[model samples]
Target: MDDVTRQKILDQIPVIDYIPKENSQAFLYLKRVLHWQQTNSKNAVLVVDDSSAARSHISALLKRRNFTVVTANNGVIALEKLKEHKNIKMVITDLEMPEMNGITLTNEIRKKYTREQLAIIGISGATSGIHSARFIKNGADDFLRKPFCPEEFYCRITQNIESLNNIAKIQHAANTDYLTDLSNRRAFIHNANHRIAEYVKRKVSYCLAVLDVDYFKKVNDNYGHDAGDQILKVLALYMRKHFGGD
Candidate 1:
């Protein structure tokens, strides 16, 4: 290349500047946000694989992503771990294992915990599609073929956890009052109807009562919306303490 062309090309290259310590408020804020993301990525994960090397590798990867990891060598031990760690939100299990394989574990888990509460991902080295199909049909939320890339593994784990969190948030909003953090009218109606149906089916006696705050409108008018809200919250708390049940 000619000297003049080389000089022109070098001049056209963009120069990057590092942020100064005194003027790095935005950079600091970005760092905080990333830290928060890493901290809240996963609650806990159970890794079930017969191979010690594979379990170690998976646990290391999850720990790097700021996840609490517990491991089990077989499905039976995985169930025990699940019982011991009630906060485990996700499970990664190998399809082929000794003493209760992945499919049986998934089925047993589903009997107690729904997809909204727990996320299950099955991994297998077998190329047969039947294994994957069987896993999903038996209540596995996702399936991964073994020897997968680390990126794909983490991606699937993140997606499943996010999905479960979204479902929980939706259910909470549906069943809870926004202001008082108590059960809403819809929840009350649903539960009351269920109890009524069960009682009627069994020919049992039950009592129903309705209570309301007297002069609620006067309180709102005389005090203020804030005072009225406080009164409602107190009333809700009293009800919860005295009359709450399934």
Candidate 2:
């Protein structure tokens, strides 16, 4: 903090000195903030394998890295676990499971989650090249051979998760307006065209409208660009409130 800000906070300390530290409002607020950070900082990973040893080993490794781990014995249970745990960001599955193999699990997961939403990494003991090939073809972000070293395992997990995060960042930057934080013209056109195609394919009725802000140029001319930006932000909020679903 700068000197002014630091001194201002220091000046306020005397005002609350009479209160016990444990009962102080500032202390309680800080405690809540810290707790929230601790809770939210860890991304959850789902580990699926028929072998108990494999699940336990993977879970242990992930937990050591501060990732919250959920385990399942097979793909069926993994699907149920995914439904139960909404925080699960990634899945690491073994390919030789009984109920649903990792390939089938990856395909099923893709039906609901894009790679940006949830990442999948397949692991198996098989020496055949086809396992890794099929895993990737079925929406697995990456694949690892069984008995992977801790370094290799962690690297794969980190890379896949980072790839998903980077993709999400790129997509947000591409689709969002910088000033108003609303959908940009390119995003609107792309999405509208997609919806139009779908609606036409299904022979469904649809409506499309373009909204123009009147006197926008006048506002910028009269009040400066900053005021015009504020106006645009307010208009964006109103649109989000009224037409967000559409």
Candidate 3:
């Protein structure tokens, strides 16, 4: 960044009476934000609003925080934008719009994306809280009233994104084997059940096969546990190579 831009960002940090013992979280967050803007130029958060002013205001706030942003005037355009941009991680939609409303958009988006895959936040200028409830009931991850403070907006966006990352990490740990980095037994059973169900629905013929590693325990008894672990890793890789398709 240029010196002027760097100085602008430094000036935005809250002033305090004394220097912190270590770098503040705000400082660290801003630094990471800058890095993300540079590295993730293609990834975006989608903003949907019928009003041009609202779209511009929200898009500017996101860009100021160094988030890549995509904007649409309504839910229909928003869905089109999502199809065009595969890297969108979040959607912020206004409740009232032309073409399609926010609640309907949320429902449609949830049909294709899980909460773990994409986050959605609903915003509205309406007086009734029922709109917020409807947004949540339809699958929004969060709701914010219109005329919200930027601090609250930033917090909500970051928190939801963090939640998605945390959930993905938890699922990865649950499904993946530690040593071989392949799907563990739990994941295998889960996926197999789903696939088998689909095959049955389609009236497809399928068979499950079990292969035994001959004298596998003897290899461990003779060579060592490490050698046995290596053998398992190699077998996992071979299986992936030959039968990897879903």
Candidate 4:
């Protein structure tokens, strides 16, 4: 801080949150606080495997670590389980299931949901060269070879759930407009810029218009402000209607 500003600050507050020249420590503390707030809380998991023994063992292990566990016998049953228990955070699926296998279930997961909403972990006793590659390529976040130690299994589940939570928190912070649930200014500008660039590359003609409500000032004068909020909403709706992105 400059001398004048530092003097003024010292005058305003006798004690400072950071010592002079200790900005690095302050920044470190800030980052730690942010990470703590963003970490995902504990989660529920679903175990889908053809082998009842594997399913029971894995579920028992995860439950021991304080994770809620549910089981399904096949892909069809897994889908039903998902609908019934929407809180399921991750899936520990076995590849060689009877009715529906892990691969098919992963495809459905990628098509229907998000990575943060649900994480996939592929497990198999067979060789991993082919199956593991395919599992991860599809959507599985991590994989553990069968006959692994229970400690390793629990560690993987705990880490995956924690990582998913951090990602969800960061994504929310990035995509959400703090003032409203709609996309924030940063995201809006990004998508808008991408579209304009694509249009330029394609030699497409497009008109860019800026719209704000007239007499917005009067809203502050009359309705105790934030009245312009409705106008913005209506504008968003109209834009959705008129723009081809609709």
Candidates in order have lDDT scores of: 0.83, 0.82, 0.84, 0.76
Ranking by lDDT: 3, 1, 2, 4
Measure candidate 3: CA RMSD.
5.5
Give residue 246's error in model 4 in angstroms. 23
User: Which residue pairs clash in candidate 1?
Assistant: none
* TM-score per model over all chains: 0.71, 0.65, 0.71, 0.57
Per-residue CA lDDT of model 3 for 29-52, tens digit only, reads 666455554644454899999999
State model 1's lDDT: 0.83
Clashing pairs in 4: none
Q: What ranking of all candidate models by TM-score puts the best one first?
A: 3, 1, 2, 4
TM-score of model 2 vs. true structure: 0.65
lDDT (Cα, 0-100) at 239 in candidate 1 = 80
Local error of candidate 1 at 34, Å? 3.5
lDDT of 2 by residue, 21-119 (tens): 445785864564344335433579999999999999898777655678899999999999999999899999999889799999999999999988999
The per-residue C-alpha lDDT of model 1 at residue 47 equals: 97
lDDT measured at residue 77 in model 2 versus the true structure, 0 to 100: 95
Higher-ranked by lDDT: 2 or 4? 2
Clashes of 1: 0
Error of 1 at 66 (Å): 1.4
